[model samples]
Target: MRGIDLFLTLVVMLSLGAVLWPFLFYPLILRMLTTRPEQPGQGQPPSASLLFCAYNEAVAMPEKLANLAMLKRRHPQLQILAFDDGSSDDTAALIAAQGDLVTLVQGPGRSGKAHGMKRLAVRARGDVLIFTDANVLLDAEAIDNLLARYADPQVGGVLGSLHYLGEGKSATASVGSLYWRIEERLKDEESRTGNVLGADGSIFSIRRALYPDFPDSVLDDLTVSMAVIFAGKRLVKAKDVIARERLVAARGDEYRRKVRIAARAWHTHGHLRPQLRRMSAIDRFKYASRKIVRWFGGLFILTGVMAAFALALRIAPLLAMVGVTLALILLALGLRSKGGPVAAVVDILIAYAATLQGVFKAMSGRTVTVWNPAKSR
Candidate 1:
């Protein structure tokens, strides 16, 4: 029993390390070894479509439309399309008000983002499809920068960086903002080496010809990125292209978003596993090591907790107590720290807690039906 406890603890710790090291450390190593490639010429720009899916987003419609108009001015050939997903608000009317400047799609009811995207895709006339969220403000050069990456035939998709606006309004929002920046840096490094695991929904561009239709329940951006990767095309990140948005200010907003994301990720795992066997050994290893383990981190945490409890009763009570004490101290420090090293530590703890919650919910056979939309940050 003692041997079993020790072994389980070791396994849990190693699994945690394997899951986080690639995303947090390998990127830094890649940056040291890589140099940015020269920018490709903007030579005849490809026809592109700007796609936005709005659900009760009337409050943001005016600014979103103005931003699209600005983008059209820069890229004269760009076409804009907006979808209203059974919004209870004035979103449909707002899109209709834009007239020819934007093509409007209305749905009988809310079918979620994946359905809206597919509907827009069917109507898209551009060779390149760029998807942006209603809440994001795209920089004037965002589309130009995104399309420029297609100059590399090896690159099939490009993901843009998201800058969190209004971050300083609250501590939670500030922490979220910092977390996003760290994520972007890690993704940029992953792209420099080869392929990014996935892209944010706010700003990612893909070839319309390569787009795959996915179930509405799955996370649309992740499904799109994985589909492209499984097709043997590279999905790269465009750090120069920026989309800015405010952090959702509410405390529970992040928690709700994480839960839905965890559920979708769990679902996507099975869908993506069959394709993994066909990928290069490096990619296969990277995906399993970095992504698969993290998805199961909550299980490991529970295992670790169980092992600690068993070991305390059977053998080293003092050591077990010390370990628990240390964990509490770390968590407390994390909660009190501003958005820096301490806050980052807190983010990790919060992430771990959320992961644990997801695992518990899954184990209890609880169907996660309540889709709490993320607060705009």
Candidate 2:
């Protein structure tokens, strides 16, 4: 009975820690509350490169290029590079039609986004490299807002705010959008105080000198941003600089994305050990709280529930009943096709499960480099 009690206590503590780790951003929040808005930079604009990777985005490519063209008008010094990762669609032709307006790189087949980015970097001439996706729409002032932080010599990267464009009033979309809001708020605070663990892949910029030639297995956003932090440079936020992308509408698509992200995160964990040790005390804490704990948290949740059930059977039925009831509620929502508060709970559970699978795959020497864009958007 004593051993049982101890096991239950350990399980509960682990579960609670997993749940509460996100609140670690609160201190950074307090710092932001005391700070004032920064003035815009007055220095001449540095040579900047806008880089993007295209898969099969023929329909969206023209509009995206138009936006970049307008941005180019505003900042003539900006250079643009586009790479088509073996797209079977008109993506290549559209890029070819751009002529001298854009520099097109021959992507060596569908070698995945990380490899494509590495290839593009070799040809980038700008002191600052802005990486983004083809699907996201960037505001005209986004570049200006991002470059503003370069005025500070220590700032190595700037992450732009990502806002999700809802397809309709679906509950699933709401849940995903709400999650992004919470994530962005945490990132905002982290950027205000120190460094963001990673940047929004839809829109982020870093100094060309700080670029890490990450292997194809790593997530570009997390790898590059963390590399900046590990290099003893700060990453700041430009919330006014916004990029928009449509939210994935289906729960299954969302699940797959979480799985892919988790798998890459697990890969990053092992690959970055040396750099992790080089991190400052505060940055180390941030990485552990933001990345490590969350990756393996699903196991804690599962263990906590099993232990709670056993304890309830022996001595605490009421607490066990409450846990069981909540679990059922989440389970039912997860099985459903619709979105709501229950669906949100279901999404969280799915994410936790994906994290477990991702970690397991990573531990077993499995690596996932190629990606299939979810069709649910």
Candidate 3:
């Protein structure tokens, strides 16, 4: 009942609220604000360019090239562009062997995906540019679905739904898959209410003219997609326009991937600060809720738990120790990386820690521009 205790309790509450706001309340708020379902307009398919940047993706090249071949056959005019990021593997050769199927651009060195994408974008002559990963496979109708959205002049971009192939394979995969599902739901809501904030590289498309030049350190998908909103156009998600990729099942690989992604995301936030400020109030709310707040999740959870433990200690030292012991036990169980509730919680905590590491790296002006495809994925 002391003022200091009350203040500590209040801090704990606020921290918890900030941490959970994005994951829990944000969706509910979106549901309240969401308008009628978004529907694509009717029209002939747009002239489209499929662009992807690859780094040492030889393992997936054969299947990927075949997929692209199928797409090219489906839409004969679809311009397919590929950038080889100075790979030591046969990636360039494989892409080159396809000859005209893919307009292959070889980078001088490891310039990175963003740099390669910029190069591809410049050469792309299509009306709409579709960006995706080398390993991600799109549904047969994904291109048609994506192109149909641009029938509405107000539609500047469309994000495709991504499904993970290995959800229950491991604790890490399960949590990652579940987290992705929640993200998709949020994107759906964001699309219905307004712009979907940003897009992922797995599958998304934008008007070719709206492609904005950005630094290599920033996340290209997010930067390019958000520009559509900045251009006063809707960036909606089409559930039928789907892409599929395997989840990184190994704990270490997934952790490193999240860390790399988070770090670049934070760096991108810093770069886009001015433009982000110019967004509509509602979009600003969505960005802050869905992105800014979630990035600090690790810090919030740490702060809240420490404050709660301190308050509990002030009340009863034995009870505080008991609670701490129980938490540590659960964390140890999670560290084993087996599938279960305890392991899932541990996996989430580890993810938060990785993300926090990434955010801190961005704060320290360190970022990951170049990347190798996750092997376990």
Candidate 4:
């Protein structure tokens, strides 16, 4: 019995370590080993399509159009197009109001963003397709910076840098911003070394010829980025091409977004698994460690909770109590702090919870659809 308990404890610790190492430790080591090079000046321009997918974004379309017009003035030759995903709002009218600065496509019904993107892809006339959200504001140089990476012929896709513009002193916004900073650092290092696992949907560019038509409900960026990688092409992260957006005001808003993202990830895992055998060993490890394990972190947390409970009843009650108490302390600290020590702790906990929620949701054969609006903080 003692040996069995020891083994179980060891297994739990190892599993937790496995999940944390890539997300937390790997970046630290990579940062120490490499530094991002200075971004070069704007190079030769490539004909590109700035694709925006909007869903009920009437309230924000006017601002988006203004930004697009600015981009057009700067890029001059760049083509811009947008799609309204069965929006009940006046989004279509707003796009129509933009005239030729933007082209508008209306979906037959409310299919997902992926469907809208596929529709847009068919009409895209540029050699490169840059996808961005309706609410995000791109800096004047963003499109230029993104296109410059194509100077490297081996680069198939480039990810835009995302910055969160949170309201005055919101803890949720603070934590989210900090999390993205960490993600950016990791991607920067990954790009320097030659591979990026995925791209954020807020902004990312891919070769039009390399574009893969994804299912309407799939996580579009992940699917498209991974497809580029698996095609023997390098997907690089462009730290200089920045896009800025306000963080969803409320923690609930972030949670709802994460749930949809996790659900789409689950679907992506099924479709991409078969291709695993064909990937290089390094890529296989990266996908498994960075993506697969992270998605299941919540299950590990639940298991740890169960194991702690069982151990408390069987033996080493003090150790189990201490562990639980420590976890609570971390959670409390995370809630109180900005993007500092507490935020890191809180992110780990959130990752665990989200992962666990996704697993149970999958096992119970429950499907998550319909967006739940998150409260603004």
Model 1 scores a C-alpha lDDT of 0.75
**Cα deviation of 10 in candidate 3 (Å)?**
1.5
By TM-score rank, best first, the candidates go 3, 2, 4, 1
Give the per-residue lDDT of model 1 (tens digit) for 6-98: 786686676556555656655555667555453465456678998988888878878888988898888878889888888887878988988
Each prediction's RMSD over C-alphas, in Å, is 3.7, 2.8, 1.4, 3.7
Estimate the lDDT of model 4.
0.76
Tell me the tens digit of each residue's lDDT in model 2 across 1-377.
88988888787777876766665544443454444344454677677898988888887888888888889899888889988889988988998899667888867688888888888888999999999998888999999878878887788888999999873545667777877887888777777666777775899999999999778888887888777887778888888989988888887787778878888778877888898898877677767776687787788788776776887767877877887888787787566747656766777777788778888888888867767666766
Better of 1 and 4 by TM-score: 4
The Cα error of candidate 1 at residue 190, in Å, is 1.9
- The TM-score between candidate 2 and the true structure equals 0.90
Go through the candidates in order and give each one's C-alpha lDDT: 0.75, 0.80, 0.92, 0.76
> Model 3 misses residue 19 by how many Å?
1.7
Off by over 4 Å in 1: 1-12, 28-43, 305-347, 356-372, 375-377
Model 1 error, position 297 (Å): 2.9
Q: Which candidate has the highest TM-score of all?
A: 3
lDDT of 4 at 304: 65
Q: lDDT tens digits, residues 1-377, model 4?
A: 98878977876787667667767777665556554343444457579998878877777778888888899999888888888877787888989887789888988877777777888989999999999988889999998788888877777888989988863445666667766787887788878866788887889989999998666656687888888888888888877898988776455566667766787777766767777678887667667766777777776667766865785757777877887898788888777766565765675577467656765565555534334224362
